[model samples]
Target: MAKEKLNYIHIIVTVYVLQLGVDMFRMSNMLAEDFGTNGWIAILIVSIFVVGIIYTIGLVYRLGEGKSIFEILENHLPKFMLYPFYLGVAVLWTLIGTFIGKHYIFVLQMLSFPTTSQSIFNGMLIFLAIILFSMGIYNMVKAATIFFFFTVWTIFVVAFYLPEFEFIRLTTHFFSGGDGYIKGFYRVFVTFFGFELVLLLFPYMQKNTPVFKATLIGHLLLTSAYVIASIVCFGVFSLYQLKYLLVPGLELLSYIELPFVERVESLIFNLFIGEVIVSIGFYFWGAQEMLIRLFRKHSKAKKAKKLTLALIAGIFVYSMQFDTLIQVHEMLHKLSLFHTAVIFGLPIVLLSLLFWEKRKEKKSNAKSI
Candidate 1:
């Protein structure tokens, strides 16, 4: 039997789930630091650009006519020239994906496994990602679909803070707080990073798939989640406290009380494990697929699987040097710059190439006539 293709809903859920990574833990805090009172406005501003990015991605899909990014570039460029670029991007994705998982492990260590060595959790996370990637994109989407329900509830948890949410705490200052406006914008913009990976999913969709609709829906959902989180935190905490709090979202959840259970943030944090896993799996799969394309080993299943294992092992070994969350934070801070470059740069480059290719073909046809 032939494998199943992704439908509209699968793509929507994937975009929503994947775009929301460990970033949620701290997005509100970033907004507070950068844009004091009603900093959630920054999220809305960044989202306008994100909508443009998604629209540009949609243009790439229409122009490419149902091809993955690698396929489009490889069609027009020589492997000798393109493979080097491919290798560089694959390595970048590998590092970003690996460390993203590693960053989550670092936080998990502080939250629940203060004494346990991180090697165990890091290894398990990567291993789980490998397994998910091995199942291929189709199965991975289905799995993320299930996990979507698992973590989506956390978005609604903001309602619990309403009683304590005082509008007076939300000062009228428009864009009050800031270490630097540009850096704050960058931090909030990074939350939407993973949606760019959807450019690779075109080849997996069926002919009738309403991909851009799904993409827009998913992107909007993630924006709402972040913006709502920002509003809740702004209402509940003073600007000083919001700026200092590392992750106001998690801290807010940590305050929830119930007759049967106390300190349920840890339990809720466990639910996020599924989201983190799905996000990492997509990134790792992106890396692995890029490597496979670069090496011309796309047909060799065993070799591709081994390549994934090697990537996973290499990432784990690389992660061991980190003994502090500060180190991971610093490293990720640097990586996000490169990650942002690709998120915007790649699509624009592809669109330019596609347009250039069309113009060249038009010239050839004119000469032939």
Candidate 2:
């Protein structure tokens, strides 16, 4: 049977949701602390870099003829070269996803499940992600699309907090002498991290789909959302309040007073559950793709998927060793730096090799002709 193909819309929705989910929970507050009133400026600046990165990703996809990075490395490089590079990609993605998952569990522990075992929560998330992966990538996109709608209204919900925002909090000294702006820029840069999933998703997209256009739209959508969220949080809280907040976007929702719900932030957090699933699902799919490609001859084998799930579980168990939020955040910051290098640096290396290979091929063909 021929494989199913995902549309450009699926890519847009999945990437946007994945990026938005991480930023709302982990990034918005850190951004407020880093840039103070000028955080949105950092977001905008980083967005231009993001657009360039997305374009490079699309170009690399074209150069590789829509193969995932693993497939490209396999075809073009030796096993020794391939395994280490591919393994790093897989492990980095899995670790990043686990860190994000840990944050979510910690949030739940503080807000609702103080006495419940976090292991249970962690296991449940892993179980759900495996189920989603088993359904296939098409279904992952569909699930993300559904979740996109479920949680997108949270953007509108942010408007409720606007009345409390002190507009004066927007700084005139956006690029002041303090290193906070630079630090904030780096922190916010990670918020743009999830869009690199395109490197893996390229092969799954429908042949005629416009990958470039889809990614451009997706990056812009995420940029708008992040900038708005940062602005809202900066406006709502002073420097002192924002510096201490673990999840400022969630905290923003705390100020909402709806006639129906007593604790509005709780409702918002519940809605974000869908987004968490989608974000983790994207990473899981990437890790699963790399794992299967590395070990199995056939990508579609049931055994490969089972092994992938097992590996994901192992990574999750290892991540649980970092019990405290501080430890998890510190580790994530280091990983984020590494991730920036891998996602951008790996593609440039591949693209260079692809270019050299193409030139060599043209010369050989010219002689043969």
Candidate 3:
């Protein structure tokens, strides 16, 4: 049931959860460094750009009649060309899943359990993602919807910081404090990276699902979260303070002393574990879909199970190589570059192919007429 049917709500929550990830915690820090005093504006600009990309994703689904990209590309392209692209994305997505999972595990280890081995949490997460992937799109979407609620309430926690928010901290200067756009924009843009997995989601969506609109709503929801988080972060911390803080969002949470919770940040921060799992699960799903289709297997039993195990193994093995947080960030820098190309480039490629096919059909019809 790789093509398990799903509704618009599933896609909506899936997109939002997929896009948010672990980046939300450090967004203000990234923005403060990238766009400076008003670097948060990058969220708006990138939102517009990513929305356009999301539209193309919907159009590609419409044009291709909800076929999987592997199905569409395989029909129009040759095996020699097709398989490698499939394999490339499969590996790319898997690597991304690995890195993202590793990063989250590192942060959790640092926060709550300094002595606990990273491999334990990392391995458990990969195993959970493997199970999610095996459950297929319908279940994954359901799981993400639940995850969406669990983590989303934390966004409103910005309210606690309202008393301390300073308009002066936002400052009068327009984009005055950033160091460089390349690094800054990259960090901010990457926050929205996983939304591109919507391309793989086409097959699971039912006809007349209005996936286009759902994605817009979902993406806008994510943008609102980022903007609000950034605003609170800027207001609560000076530009100088933001530069040094690793996770301004968590810092916001640290100020929130609830009547029930002792470690407010810990409780809220651990909830993000759900969001990260959903994120990694989608990537692994996308990668697994490509691999399964490439082999042309009808029975998913043995093949799919084997693939899941292999991906989990790959994630663990690959993640072990990065011994330091610095190494993880360095690789994320590269992954963000690759993620940019894939999200933007996939839509362009799909559109060109569909247009070319349309032109060829018109030519043949003219001759027939």
Candidate 4:
């Protein structure tokens, strides 16, 4: 088997741009509701915390050098413990991936295709995930590079409606009472979920590259994009009005009309279909990585690919059994806590242990030498 290589810059761009899409366009309003007008401030605070986490996770990756989180676990922990730990991470990502697909399908049904069957919508999304997952990480990174540019173009197009934004709505004092800031900060933390990809992809990064710089730039880009979109949403809709909306970015675009184009939201919504696909693709890939690490025997390239495809298919089937969108959303919210714990908490712990072991190894070598 040949070792696979990816451009460091492309990975950085993909991580940041994909992060922008994961939450920026869909949940800005929900964030604003939690933080009020100061939601962007709360986002900045949460991002600071995220930056610290990314740095620590990057440190772990740098120390391990050329190994995924699973490989690191296998090296440090007993084999029996490795499988259970990896399985927990896999289940966490799978549940989150299913929820993302469910939410996207629900958005499509409500905003554009009211008559479409939920199964058909979910099936299409699963198909996209399978195709991307079938391709190796190198190809996935390439696809993400192309889609990253498209996401930038979409942002510019969405910006065209800025002049029409009602300033009063944006200026209204939602945070005037100075309450809910802590709650809003936590919600913003939840929105930055995809940063965990750094841990999963760190092993594949080019050697000697500045991982922290890439991570920082990516974080800045995503945070800026989210703030801009949140401001746009606030400007276009009153705080009170935005409270009831699920997808405020879509709703904001719904108000803008061009000389020839009447339904701008529909076009934006179509673009969202691609964004959601990429988001889920990354999650699926993360789960696949976890599974590959757990079994230990099937890390061969061909077998790994087969397992990834199978896992995606299995999750899609599970998604189809849910009868209502609300049920999926509720499950997703509950699962997110677990996802955060395993993806973020476990890495921090594992990395600390790895560092301690390395220090012990160094001390022993010094005594021997």
Query: Candidate 3 — which pairs collide?
Result: 35-39, 36-178
Worst 10 residues of 1 by lDDT: 293-302
How does candidate 4 score on lDDT?
0.72
- Candidate ranking (lDDT, best to worst): 1, 3, 2, 4
**In model 3, which runs have C-alpha deviations exceeding 4 angstroms?**
1-4, 297-301
Scored by CA lDDT, what does every candidate get? 0.83, 0.76, 0.82, 0.72
Candidate 3, residues 1-369, lDDT tens digits: the string is: 554578898888988999887788889888888778877888898789788888998898878777777666766877888778777887888888888898998888777988988888888988898788778778888999998999888888888777898898888886787888877766777888877888887767788788789899999999999999888888889998888999877777877787898888889879988888888888888887777766575666468557756866866787787878889999988877777787888788888788888899999999999
Task: Looking at model 4, report the run of 10 residues with the lowest lDDT sum.
Answer: 170-179
Model 1: lDDT to the true structure: 0.83
TM-score quality measure for candidate 4: 0.90
Q: How well is each residue in 153-217 modelled by candidate 4, as lDDT tens digits?
A: 65665567668677776564556433477666766777777777877776677775666777778
Give per-model TM-scores.
0.95, 0.91, 0.95, 0.90
Model 2 reaches what TM-score against the true structure?
A: 0.91
Off by over 4 Å in 1: 297-301, 367-369
Lowest summed lDDT over 10 consecutive residues: which window, candidate 2?
Answer: 170-179
